[model samples]
Target: MRKAWALLALLGWLCGLAPAIAQVSLPADLTQRELVIGTRVAPPFSMKNAEGAWEGISIDLWRHLAERLGVRYRFEERDTVQALLDAVTTGQVDAAAAALTVTAARRQVMDFTQPFFATGLGVAVGRGGATAWLPVLRTFLSFGFLQGVLTLLGIALLVGTLIWLFERKHHEAYGGPPLRGFIAGAWWSAVAMTQAGAAQDGPRTLPGRILAVIWMVASVVTIAVFIAGITSALTTQRLQGVVRNVGDLRSIRVGAVSGSSTVDFLNAQTVGFESYGLPAQGLRALKAGRIDAFVYDRPLLAWTIQQDFPELEVLPITLDSQNYAIALPQDHPMRVALDVTLLDTLRSEWWTRTRLRYLGNDAAN
Candidate 1:
């Protein structure tokens, strides 16, 4: 068996971060010739469970790659997404795992192994849209967000005029009682956009006390509308889902299980990205400032954050519906090895064992 030198960190750098690696051939030091690859926990592909074990399609694939190449590999259980990516950049490890997909952006930075599996984009909504407000409620009753926007403009004018005449004429949006001003503006915006005929109240010489009273009432209604809008999106969609595009995710930092189809899709689309060799890495990246959005299969990530990472919420849209595939770095030596290995593995009894290990564990749900 040929020895594949798994290099870790460049020889020298002051930052103390990992270093980039340069491959070398082995000279009979099997134990010393071991490769340390950076990786994170990406479910149904690659992940280290609470039980302290490595299991998944990607893991098995690596194991086979190591054996056929006759090299020893020690899978490092990485903690953060950035560290995993950094490891690759700095040569802290031979290569990363966790369903990493190959992409042009990443290609510019790091090399990839051949693909191992395929997965695609998924969508999620907040706990469920609120079901009480008219604006929100109206969504279920054939509502449009455009109307709410119009109402807000009209209300702003009416209030702006009254302020110009009576109150803080020179004040900006949040210039007054910070709380009062925001609540006033926000509530007005919410109301104006959701309702019709809000133009009738064009600032007819109102007192502060009277305006305050109206603002309070408007705030309450706005809350109701917000709740209703959320509820409509959730339940209605569950029964008959709404359709949205990935374009909405332009500004978001989407996370994928490294080489999964979702990562591939987002990469192909040229949306902003933060790749994770593991779901845990991506989630950690989402927290540690690597990226803002983490895109995954809706079913896989639906309750994943709520359950495993409760701080995150499902955005309003799902980008696309596509298949899942395992991707390695393009032209990786492992590509031919893994591709042929995959065909054979699919027929072997070991395949189901591999599949059951991480098949249904979608972090989203």
Candidate 2:
């Protein structure tokens, strides 16, 4: 009775392990078939070279996977990411390779390999457009700048009033009707703050002279801080264009790729934007002053701008996090093997060098 019960337990263990074993197994004819792979032109991930040969990060990954599995495959180029994904869902292609971002909505229709790259959406702006004066005017009208100016004026008024009290009886420079005397004292205080020679004579009384000496030293520090504040405000305004964050998009004319996840995000935020067929089109519109800012994937924007659009720049800010991966048909037979090999490739030193070559020194970050 004990031996019979032990045999049953062993059989149950094998039954539980069947699915795991099946997942890791390759199809007998997979190596003999020529798989159809769909791709789109998303630079640095997948794009055609000058000679019309497809090459990029995602292409290289797919190529590596094909070689490792000993499978033959041919790439079918698609004009739009939506079309490529549609092909995968309808089983027209075995896989879709590009800088495909993984989103919950997309997951409902197709599957994805393990994420190989992670980044976020970034904004881009043109350098040739006329600098908008509204930002500068806003800077002057800003609370921080106005507060600094008002504080300086307040200090000058207090110092002038004190000087008038000390010198009203003796010093001709400050001796007059109350309003006139106050004005003269304030003028002298203003000149003293700038260290510029005052048109009037110095105070004569001991108390008045002592107060003047203290104010002169204090004004040196105060004026330095005041100038620094103005300089900082203007410099920051010059650097931060009309759009600084996603919230800033509401007030500015924004552009993004049509049918992209970025468009979905903008729609969710209720920020109105012009949609372009491609990022390059939006970038050109930005340069032509048709739009105030362009938003898209960070790595693609950086690479495109660095290679062709020297007059354009990507902002240091990110809008949303994204994960880049390979898209496959739902419950693809090769999913397990692809994930296993992709994880191994990503962990290799060759992958490190490949990323650095494409993404520069900040690739690790």
Candidate 3:
């Protein structure tokens, strides 16, 4: 009985030790050789300060991981995200430490650490003006406007037919050939809808006078309603601008970052978009009215807008959900170690402060 109890205790101890052992099993060379980490200038993820020192969310996270793992590493900056990712895939760099998004195509070529941040594609548009007239034009051409016109014409026809039946024989204004009488009555009704003095030329028959009085009062209400609808439409159009959601992007001049996940999404949806080299360039185009909308990563857009492009606003729209993770060479020996430290660092209080420092209240919890 004593031997069996000791054996059971030993089994439990070994089970507990397995995870710790696996976590520290980083290859011997990973610690000895200075690891090459690739990065690109993607604001809040990777960027150089005025002093020329590199710093950002991904950079901080990597530094934390390196400190914990006791590994020496050096950063190799690349001009574009694709170049950074390519460096990782080719083992030109041991890992990519930028805002690398994990996709199936990338995964097929290089491994990725568990995602550190979650975000989606967003649209950035100029705050106001430039496209203001577009909304007004759309309002006038809208189905509601056409429907209102049709309903008004129908009412005029009905009222004119009634007035002609009562007054065609008694009043010269309405007395004529059948078609002429109808036209005269219809013109009177339309005029009365806009002017109260039009009632003076109303039909002479008692029944005709009664119908005229009722229509005059009703016309007041109709005119009020019509003016209110037009006013409301113009106000709404001016306030909401031209684009309200993703569906509105189809007809507008759209811009996107070249070689980004946003471009992939726009292509998949069959949306024609002009590609810009960077988010700042795309935003500048939008501000200058060259592009109606600029689409890119939500967090990155928020960061850029807050930092350099205050004249712009990011629409409260999200598309193409994505996860940002560290890119690494295929089956990298340090991947497991990196993931362990990454998850721990992400779950710590320091990570919260780091994110808040860069993203303000926009930081994802």
Which candidate has the top score in TM-score?
A: 3
| RMSD (Å) of each candidate, 1 decimal | 18.1, 5.5, 3.8
lDDT winner: 3
Question: How high is each candidate's TM-score?
Answer: 0.46, 0.84, 0.85
Tens-place lDDT per residue, model 1, 1-365, is 12322233232342343321222233455435777766676555565668978866667767765665567778886665556666776767766766454556666776654344544456432333331122234355544555664565566556544443444444354346645655554554344434544632223335743774675477567657766776666566454322246654564445566555576677678876766665556766665545655777654564366657765556556565543334333344444444555565556666566665554453221
* Candidate structures ordered by lDDT, highest first: 3, 2, 1
CA lDDT, every model vs. true structure: 0.55, 0.85, 0.86
Choose 1 or 2, whichever is better by lDDT. 2
Ranking by TM-score: 3, 2, 1
Q: How many backbone clashes does candidate 1 have?
A: 62
Model 2, 1-365: lDDT tens per residue?
99999999999999999756534556867667899999999989899999999998889889987777778999999887778878989999999899888998899999999999998998888763663554677788889888888889999888888888888999887887999889888888888888888536667889889989999999999999888878887777767765667887887888999877888788989999998988889989988889888999988999888888898988778888899999999998888888987887898887888777766786774
List residue ranges in candidate 3 displaced over 4 A.
1-24, 195-198, 204-206, 222-234
What lDDT tens digits, residue by residue, belong to model 3 across residues 48-70? 99998889999998998898899
